[model samples]
Target chain A: MKSKLIIYTFIICLFLTGCFKENQIEKMGIINARGIDKQEDGLVQASLVLFQFEAQAKDITKLVKGTGNSTKGAINNANLETNFLLDSGKLQIELYGKETAQEGISPYLDTLLRDARVPDTSYMAIGEPTAEDILTVQESGISMNIGQYLHGVIENSASDKLFPKVSLVKFSRLKNDIGVDPILPVFEIKEGIPKITNIGVFQDDKYVGDISIENKILFNLLDESLLSEWLEITLPFEPFKKYKRNSSSSTTEKLHVALNTLRNDSTIRVTDLEDLTFKINLNIEASLLEISNQIKLEDKRVLKLLEKEIEKNIEKKYEELLKKLQEFNSDAMGFGSVYRYSKKGKPLTRAEWRKKYPEVKADFNVNLKIIHHGETF
Target chain B: MKITNVIAPGKRIRAFYLFFIICTVQLGVGIMGAPSYIFGYARQDAWISILIAGVALILILSVIIYILSQYENSDIFGIQVDIFGSFIGKVLGSIYIIYLAMALLSVMLTYIEVVQVFIRPTMPSYVIGGLILILVIYCIWGGVKVIVGVAFLFFILSQWLLILLYDPILRMDWSHLLPVLDASLIELLKGAKASSYTLLGFEILLIIYPYIDNKKEIKLPVFLAIIYSVSTLLITTIISIGYYSLENLRDSEWTVITLFKSASFSFAERLDYIVVMEWMMIVVPNNIFLAWATTYGIKRLYNIQQRKSLYILCSLLLVSISILKYDYMILQFTTIVSNMGFWINCVYPFILATLVFFKKKRSKHKGMNTT
Candidate 1:
């Protein structure tokens, strides 16, 4: 009787297993990238680059555009248009146009963040002209497709210290962290071709403008409190300047100088309630890359002049950037976060930061050290 | 007679009951929310903390086994009464029973909240509560052996569904895990505290100990069950950390559940349905085990029969508590229960071991003096 029951149970199990066989696919529509922009009709225009499965063959990438009042609505509309469901979990990149991002990505981000379908680590970028332009970028000569190209651009920029790897998850944290403003990869269309050029800066959710053209932005910022390793930018020095030469050169000689990032290591000394001074050390390690007017290769006097000029340039840039930050009331440099995290437990909210940031006195000290040159003249 | 009658099971049921107990108790409500909670405190290192917790569980269980072995065939109740005189022993037993009841209530409430919030917002809490209660009653009515057999079947089936989760794991970015040694000590501690849920249901050994035929083999299976649970939790943590990074996992409420939904199978777009469906296999036996434990506790403490009286009392309490407190109040209540259960389960085992040892020492000394 027991043996009979066992066999009977096995048959029932096999039948039940067939009944509940999951309708799972061997391949799924993987979204590689997404672009969001605003339309003239006040709808959010979303373009998705989907990596389509091609059985036994390499995956084919396709673009699908949907429009609605919001990103979620647009995505829903797009889903309705396709036989295959839209899956954003594999999405590696998301591009928001300058105007759309400025309008506020918080709403769109809310939809993605709140939705379980969207992966949290999707890299966020800002596009110029329109997100659609970047999403539709196609070149006849390009070996890799547009989705791969766009992803490659962000990856290359990050590797070159051009911008930070700003994941959607990290953006949300930095969005809320006091004093540390968020930065994203920014793409601009030049001559109708989309290219990621600068880092899009944001104060909370609002676009605060990218870092000025001079100082290279690292994809991940080093702790501003420590004077660790800094980037060294070498340039040519003028002959008339009081400096030593790294090498003998034509009056217009190139200087092989190393410039370290020091404004990053600026100190925030909170003396009293009334005075919060940010003493910036524009400490740069430099040498001559070239010289327009130079003396001898081993002339310490000539090299000093080159170092002084390098010092002056760094200090000037630091001051200008600080002034711009004060003007914009931006804390992207992380002065606010440093203050809040460093000193005790009390954290200043957005309101408190706005009030105190302008009154803050920022002192600049440019320290120059002529470390080495590429070779003797 | 009562004990033998309650423990009787067909040979086939023995394997299934054990499997059911292990899988259901191990999976519980923790799998849904644990990654986020543990991640928040430990940051990326939460996975490390889970592995550490698993080891801690193994050690705790080993100690429990050692204590049980001292009495040979006696269980926690019999040992307690023998060691501490009946009055104090019964009081301690009552506390244990009440603690299990409270824990059962908390797990039931947690499952309800998860279902209401994620699966069905419009569905009443009692729908889940009523369904679960019916299943638990049916399992217990069939007796322990049958329940274990069912658990064994569920465990084997659920393992099949887990293969579908591999797609998301492949896309994991390990770079996001940089700056590894970053979390504050306080945060790591908080993460360890949140891991209490993952380590739940192991305490059911207190009741299940007497039912096992071979006391010697008991240690290995129980230890292996803990190891299995820890391995599952560790895998879940690694996947959550790999899929979302620490920052994202920290902010998410139902991190694992969300991750499951994020993937699309070629045949079906809805992976969340599969997850919720599999969770039924987990929740059913888990709910039944907790109910059985509560009933067992009552039987031991008050000298009530295992059937009819103890089971009915537990059913009434679980169903009413599960139904009546369905809203936000359930959240407040569960936090207290989980916090209390952690103390009762993790620490109480040690206390019993100490008490038993002390009594044995005293008796040995008296015998020596008499000689």
Candidate 2:
């Protein structure tokens, strides 16, 4: 019994000896964001936005740059210039330059996916001109670290239904899924500040092209059910000329209308299997926010006319966006997934879907309901 | 050789604890990656395969219970001795003991690998392996009651981790589950076979049979334990198939843990870290139960003290874990043990049940002839 007590004490001491490696917060270079770019000499350049914790430091964050053949190697090279041990556990965002993304972002994502220490929730995006420029942007208007600022920007936009949230896990899912491609928010430096400008579309892992910001809402509506807060559309003035409250108030050829969408539900179905044709039906509920020209809203006829015009405008825009995606040969909207599941016997391979995606035809059906025309009318 | 064990009344436990013992034991390291293994064969229909495996397990357990019920207060060791004469029975019993040791070692090594990969990489394997073995020895020293108590405690403690799976469930893409009957029947059967490893540990029922008081009441608890474990496996597999794309699911080594990795809270950033550590609670019960089975078999078969054999077995296990350092070696070891366990736990029971039935019938006829 006495000897057993001794052994128990020894075991307790073994655990209490602190044998594992220690990682102090002050000594860890917590990387909040990392940007990758391709150099002219075929080297991978990594720009890391590190959180600075030192009380005496001049800034809340610091930029560390390095060049190597791979992302890990480049990060290692950057480590030599810092006293703190680089840790990627708190990483919030990862960005790739246009060139790097065009080449393919899959190779760069290996470190993120392989490292168990890294969180899978980090947002992924593309830098228009270069990732380094976006990470190193010096702007007086921004008070917080660039990495945190960029994360907040993306998170806000995603919550507002401006774009789909693409985290590391989601990106990998889309990249690996058979019939669908991945998309990322594109950030371009404007006047020494980074601004989300477009949606970067991809064919598999390689960036094919981008969709303009004007079409982001339409893209999202087609992708899934969404509740966007604002939408602007221009319609021919000929339709509403008779309902005008003041006849000569404005001579504009087009009437501009703004809407606050309450809800938008969209569904895509295979219309013709042999012809590879799809029909997209969209149901939208919105309240009028503003109208550039005067129209008699009290008349129920005017409201129906307005809804018809808005639906026509949306259908036209949706078709144009679909055409653009087809021209780019990218299936970012997941139409191929619908096509694959709708068909029977045997699964659709990525190659087969790729060959057939560009030739696929789609018809847009929009149903817009004007719930209310604002408090006045 | 004794056909029945005279277990002291003080050492006997109620049959209700079998639910905890069987459920906790079956839910060890195998579950960490069961989804990926089954998914590789069945894809989106992996849940169907898991359900089939569960039903198969219920059938196997019924056979095992029948075999145990053939003799009063007897375990696998005693029954084997009764059927196969003294020499051959001891040999087969020793082989079963070796299988238990391998299972215990595999569970310990897998936990260590998970720690090295997920938590502390630089921590030596001996430290982890030694700590686990010491805990196992400590629990076993308290005898079967302590081991069962540990299993019961840990089973209740670790259940909260299942709630974290809600995050992954929310993120799941339901469309991934479409085209359900895509996998061929043969492929689905293979998938069910693949789940044999995770669905193991219920076979411990054979070893712990004698200690169970009110043996007539065990059928309900034991079957309930299996149903509970099978449902758990089914839910995890469905979640994994829906949450991850097929290629991604195939690539992830520990799909269940990876599912937890994506669960984030405002206060805590990495839930997987907590889960991988809390998983030690789940693993400890598994180690203790297997170690107890091995030591008990040795004592019953070879007339050796359970304490002496336990110490020797644990020391050897510690040394082996330290030496088997490479990832590939650990992988190979796990594959070998799982394959062996599949046959021992799943197929061997039916054969044993048939042999026991014939042996009982023959003994009754001999008695009648004498009369």
Q: Model 1 chain A — which ten-residue stretch has the worst lDDT?
A: A218-227
Per-prediction TM-score, chain A only?
Answer: 0.77, 0.92
Tell me model 1's lDDT, rounded to 2 decimals: 0.67
lDDT of 1 by residue, A1-377 (tens): 99999999789867864543242443556678889998878999899888776566563777888998888789878877665567675677888888888877888888778765566556788887688887777655456656677777666642444555677766766776556677777877655455667667787777768765344432232322223334444465444434444463445445544443333433444444447777655444444454344445466776576567666666666667767777777766666654554454443577888788877776667666666654754
TM-score of chain B of each: 0.89, 0.98
Model 1 segments beyond 4 Å from truth? A1-28, A54-59, A158-161, A218-236, A239-249, A253-274, A279-316, A361-377, B1-76, B79-251, B255-333, B336-371
For candidate 2, report its TM-score: 0.95
Q: Could you tell me which 10 consecutive residues in candidate 1 chain B have the lowest summed lDDT?
A: B1-10
Model 1 RMSD in Å is: 9.0
Query: Candidate 2's residue-wise lDDT over A304-364, tens digit each?
Result: 9899989999999988988999989898888988887889987899999999998999999
- Provide DockQ values for all models, in the order shown: 0.12, 0.75
